[model samples]
Target: MMTTAVPAPAISVRGLEKSFDDLRVLRGVDLDIERGSIVALLGSNGAGKTTMVRILATLTRPDAGTVMVDGFDVMTDGANVRECISLTGQFAAVDQILTGRENLKLVAKLRHLDDPGGIADEFLARFDLVDAGSRRVAGYSGGMRRRLDIAMSLVGNPPVIFLDEPTTGLDPEARIEVWTMVQELATRGTTVLLTTQYLEEAEKLADRIAILHEGRIVANGTLAELKELLPPAEVEYVEKQPSLEDIFLALVGKNAPEGELR
Candidate 1:
């Protein structure tokens, strides 16, 4: 039988460490993200989530240990690492003065991709921004801007994406909209490393969750496995009720435009 070698993980980190002056942000952190999977990195404020992501994106140098993205060593092959990944920061990095379509074209043109105009149009239609494509991004809603930001990240169709708190500052409806876009990425076999403060977001999106606590990945597993780490829950019966999210979505999702805030 002919044999095919297994592909490397989309991202790999081993004994990673970073610090600023006296404060150590990441300490002996180790993580791996399988290709085409969505892995959530969960940590509290100052728990080094952003630091971990920055290192992965090659924006910050690690104090120690090996890090790799798409089989390229981040330390020695920074350019190759960058070529394989896109980083979408907490805030939408769109030019406020440019129309939504212009923002997408700019990223494509910057990458020297052929047919920037067509690429921009494709993303606009795919992201449901065709209607707003001509409007300056300054007038865009929170969800629309985020969609465009992510659309821009997809310009080269890089194999890996780093979304740092991708849905920050969005209303409930907008948050759901962004979540759908993320799911679509995974379906298309794009690897994603997501850092977020929202526990529910991880619960909903991640195939596996890695919790960074006390400068290390204290737990990494599926939701069921993580739940198993705690003592079994007490069994009880109560009247069933809708959560705030349920009620909010019921009243908002049906009537709003795809990603517009209600």
Candidate 2:
């Protein structure tokens, strides 16, 4: 019988450390993200999630520990690590002055890829922005702008994508749109590591959830696995009935003036 070796993770961090003067952002954090999977980094406002992402993307150097992306060391092989990763920050980085298509083309050109126009066209169609391709990004909706920003980050098909608080300021509807987009990225074999404070977002998107607290990953596992950390709740059953509010709404919908309840 022959045994197959396990493949290396797309992104790996061990004993990572970082500090800013008196503030220590990360302390001996370790994580491994499998290839083509979505891993949500969950933390509160000051949990250093962004700091960890910056180090992985090679935008910031870690004070200690070994970090690797796509088999390339972030400290020693910075360029290769960068080539393997794309970082999308909290806010959309699209140009308000340029058309949505132009923004994609600009990124494609910067990456030195052949046929920027074609790349732009492909992404615009893929992100369902073909109609708004020619309109200035300033006129696009929040969801549309976010989609375009993500498409720009993917111009060169980087193997790993870092989304740092991707849906920070979007409305509920817009947030849902971005959530769907994140799911699509994983389905297309793109490895995504998104940092977010929204617990529901992590529950809905991540294959595995890692909770960062006080500069360390305190918990890491799937939703069910995390649930096992706590004692299971006592199962209870009770009769249910519609409340007065629910009954009133139901009645209004059927009998209100001109069906105005809608």
Candidate 3:
């Protein structure tokens, strides 16, 4: 008789707990993210979203609980966990003095890739930064800098990536561009865990959504599943119209061809 093997989750958390002195940041949190899927950790500020990402990325140790990335225990196999994951925090980490190409090359070289130059060029083109690759990062627009930050994370092609509020502070068009890039990453088999404040962003990109409220996940599931948890909508007389976000985007396109707020 033949048997099938069950693949381990790309990311798994069990009874996760964290604290900063007397303040509890995460309270008995548990999560599981499957391979090649995108999971959005939605939360308000101080909701422990960044803390969870840090623990999973091996940057910080949790006070209690098990965290596994690609089947490796984060605590005991921190180095192995790091090998399988890349993290881009809330802010861009690129060096202002280095050209975009240089930033990619630096990451590639640090990871000891055989052909750093080739890898740099590949990411530059992939992230739509080839034209701006030679210019110092300081001169790059907010969108361009964010793209480069993500591009640098992909230098080693880790199977899992953590993006913490990746689209924050971007104009609408730039936010959409980053959202598109995130979808592309998941399509290519990278499991992505992103923290975001935007409900619309999660609805657009996530295979599953986990809402963290005051250090605990209040809801976790597919969009429809999560919606099921909400109270039934009250009957309305008027037909439903577009959301404010939709109306805002439409207006921006019409009133500002460049997509910038004056």
Best by lDDT: 1
Residue lDDT tens for model 1, 1-262: 9999988899999999999999998999988899999999877689899999999989999999999899999999999999999999999999999999999999999999999999999999999999999999999999999999999999999999999999999999999999999999999999999998787898899998887766887667777655544334344754444332332233233442232110
Clashes of 3: 0
Which ranges in model 2 have alpha carbons more than 4 Å from their true place?
Answer: 235-262
lDDT of 2 by residue, 1-262 (tens): 9999999999888999999998988989989999999999876677798889988888888999999899999999999888878999998999999999999999998999999999999999999999999999999998899999999999999989999989988999989988998999899899999988777788799998787766877667776666544433344655344332232233223432222110
Give the Cα error of residue 198 in candidate 3, in Å. 0.9
Screening candidate 1 with a backbone cut-off below 3 angstroms (N, C-alpha, C), the clashing residue pairs are: none
Backbone clash count for every predicted candidate, in the order shown: 0, 0, 0
Candidate 1 vs candidate 3: the lDDT winner is 1
How many backbone overlaps does candidate 1 show? 0
> What 10-residue stretch in candidate 1 is worst by lDDT?
253-262
Rank order (by lDDT, best first):
1, 3, 2
Question: What TM-score should be assigned to candidate 1?
Answer: 0.89
Error of 3 at 236 (Å): 3.3
Q: Give per-residue CA lDDT, model 3, range 6-31, as digits (tens).
A: 78899999989999999999998888
